[model samples]
Target: MIFIEVIKKRFGHFEGETVWQWTMINDHGMKISVLNYGAIITSIETKDKFGEYANISLGFSDMDDYLAYSPYFGATLGPVAGRITKGQFSLDGEEYQLTQNEGANHRHGGKLNFSKKLWNVSVEKELDQIVLTFEYTWADGENGYPGNINAHMTYTLNNKNEWIIDYTAHTDKPTIYNPSNHIYFNLSGKAGSTILPHQLWVNSEKFLPIDKEMLPIGEIRSVENTIFDLRAGREMMEIIKNQDELLQIAGKGLDHTFILKHENGKPDAVLFDPQSGRRLEMETEADSVLVYTSNSMAGDFEINGKTVPKYAGITLETQGLVDAINHPGFGNIVLRPEKPFKSKTAFRFAVES
Candidate 1:
C-alpha cells in the first residue's frame, strides 16, 4: 500500500552530479518534501486546529536560499551537534584534535559536516504513512573526526499526526557521532509571530551548567527554584525574562540541556499554543534535551522575512549532553563496528478544544 513520486531538477551539467526533488504525502494529508542535495527538508505541511494546512517548519523556498541564506533550518545536523571543547579529545590513549572552524571550539561538525554534503535519498509511500530515507558515507578524518561511518536517517509521518525521526549510524573506527535534525518549530507558522505565548513543560530536575563557550561544567545543578525548571507548563519567554538568576547565570536566554527525568514510556515535554489551539507532545530516548530560542535570527533570509524577532522560535533538540566526549561521567560516544548506534524521537501534534 505505498505510492512514489519523483521530481527532478537541473543542477547544471557537472560530471558527477544528481539533483532531484521528491514529495511524499500520507493518507491524512501530511506531506514532506526532500531534495537530493544536502538531504534537506524542503517543506512540511500539516493541518492546524482550524483544519487548515500550512508549513510548520522553517525552510528556504528553493535550493539557492538553502545554500546562501539559511542557517541550519530543517537540515540534518550530524557527526556531532554541539561544541567539542578546544576541538580536542582523547580516545583509547590517542589524542585527536579537530579543526576549530567556529572561534575556538568545533561547532556543528566542523566546516563541512553532513549538513553540507549531498545525500542519497529514497522515498517510501504507504497507505497511511510516508517515509523519506537518507544515507551518507563518511571517510576517516573527513571533518577532523576519526571514523569511516555510514549513517542512515528515516523520517516518517503517520495518519495519527505524528512525525517521527530515527537515526542509525555505525563506524569502522571508534568516533563520536551525534545526529539530529535542526527543524525550527513555529507552531503558529513560519511567518507567524513569536512563540512566547506557547506553554511548555519539561520533565527534568537538574541541568548541566555551562561556561561562556557553552561547555558543560561537570556538575548537574538542581532546578528547584531556577528558571531552568519548566515543570509547570509556563510561558517560555515570560519565565526567561522574569527570572533574574537564570539571566545572570546564562545571560539573556536559554541554550542549555535539561536532563530528562523519564523512567517509563511517556512524553518528556509538551508544548501548547492557545491562540492557535495547537499542541505538540515530544517523546525521545536521548539523555538530555536542549531548548534553544532563536535569539540571533537576523533579517538576512528573504521571502516573507522578519517574522521571528529575538527569541522567536524554540528548538527542542534531543541528544546527549554537550561535550560528552570529554566528560567521563556524562557518558561516552564510542560507536564500534558491531554495535549500531541508534536514537529515536517523536512529535505528536493535536488540536485542543
Candidate 2:
C-alpha cells in the first residue's frame, strides 16, 4: 500500500512553503518516499532476503536541512546543468558571463540556481507521483544568460518500484538550457561508509576529456584500459585507487561525463549493492551522464545535526555535456521560440533476492 502526507512550514526566506511526500510500496514491502522538494528521494526502505528493512539513501529530516545544503542531492538543476567554462558562454556571436560558483567555471547553474528556488507543488496520490513546476525569466541577461524560460519537473513512482522523472521546458527567446536532477545514492543508507563495494556498469565507449579547469577540451577519448571503463561491471573500490584521467580529474574519485554509445533511450547504467541485494537501474533520453563520486563531501556541511562523509554518496546525472552550448560536436542545448525543450530520466530500484 502507498501513503502520502502534506507538509507546510515557514522555511528559509520563503513563507508558507509546502512539500508533498509520496510513499510507494511494492508487494515485497519495500517502501520509497519521494518529497516534492527537488523531487528528492528522502528514503528507500527495503527488506533484505533475511527480512530486515534498511534505508538505502541519504538525506535530512526537514526543509531547513535541505535549505542549507549546497550539496544538490536529489535536486533538479537547470538553465544549464554541469560546468560552464570560464564562468561564461558565447551565443549568437556574443559572450555572456555567469556567476563563478565553481572556481572559474559556472557549476550546476551557478549560485542561487533553480534547485534553491521553491517550486509549485502538485500531488497525484493515485499515480504515486509529484509534479513540481517553476518559471524563470532571464530578462536579456540574468546570470549573463539569455531569454525567458519556463520549466516543469514531474516525478513518479510505479508499482514496479521505478521513479520516473520527466522534465519539460520552453523559452520565448533564444537561450542555452540543460536541465537535470542530482540524486545522491548510498546503497547502505549510511554516511562515512565507502561506496567502493558497490558494483557499477555504464554503457559507454568514449568520454569527453577535461582541461585543468574541468572544462571539456573538445576531445573524446575511449574508456578502454582506463579506470573509466565500466563496460564490464567492477567494484567501485577496485578502480578508486587507480591513477587514471577520470580519477585524477575528480581528485580521488569520478566526475566525468560518459557518452552513451547507443542512444536507444533504454537504461545505460546499473549500480548493484551486493550486500543489500538491491539494485538501481538508470534509464534516460539524455545523451550523456555525469557520474560523480562524492569525494569532496565533508562532515562540515551538516544538515539536521547529522554529518555526511565523503565517498558516502554518489550522483548519476543524465544530460548534455557540461558546456554543450560552446561545443558544437556535443548535443545542442539551445532553446528558441520555435523549438520546445523536453528531457526525461528515471531511476528504478529492485531487489535481487
lDDT of 1 at 29: 70
> Best candidate per lDDT, number?
1
The top-ranked prediction according to TM-score is 1
Sliding window of 10 residues with minimal summed lDDT for model 2 = 4-13
Residue 309 in model 2: lDDT: 69
lDDT (C-alpha, whole model) for all candidates? 0.76, 0.74
**Clash pairs detected, candidate 1:** none
Taking all chains together, each candidate's TM-score versus the true structure is: 0.91, 0.88
- RMSD for each model, in Å, please? 2.7, 2.9
- Show pairs that collide, candidate 2: none
Clashes of each: 0, 0
Q: Which ten residues in a row have the lowest lDDT in candidate 1?
A: 6-15
Could you give candidate 1's per-residue lDDT for residues 1-353 as a string of tens digits?
A: 53333344554211267556666666667667666666767677777778887776677666667667657777777688888898998887889999887788897788787778888877776766777788999889977789899999888877777879899998998888877677677777647467778888999998888887777877888889777778887787686677564454555677788899986866899888787777888989888888877766775555456544665577888888778888877876777788989999998987785
Q: Global CA lDDT of candidate 2, please?
A: 0.74
Error of 2 at 117 (Å): 0.2
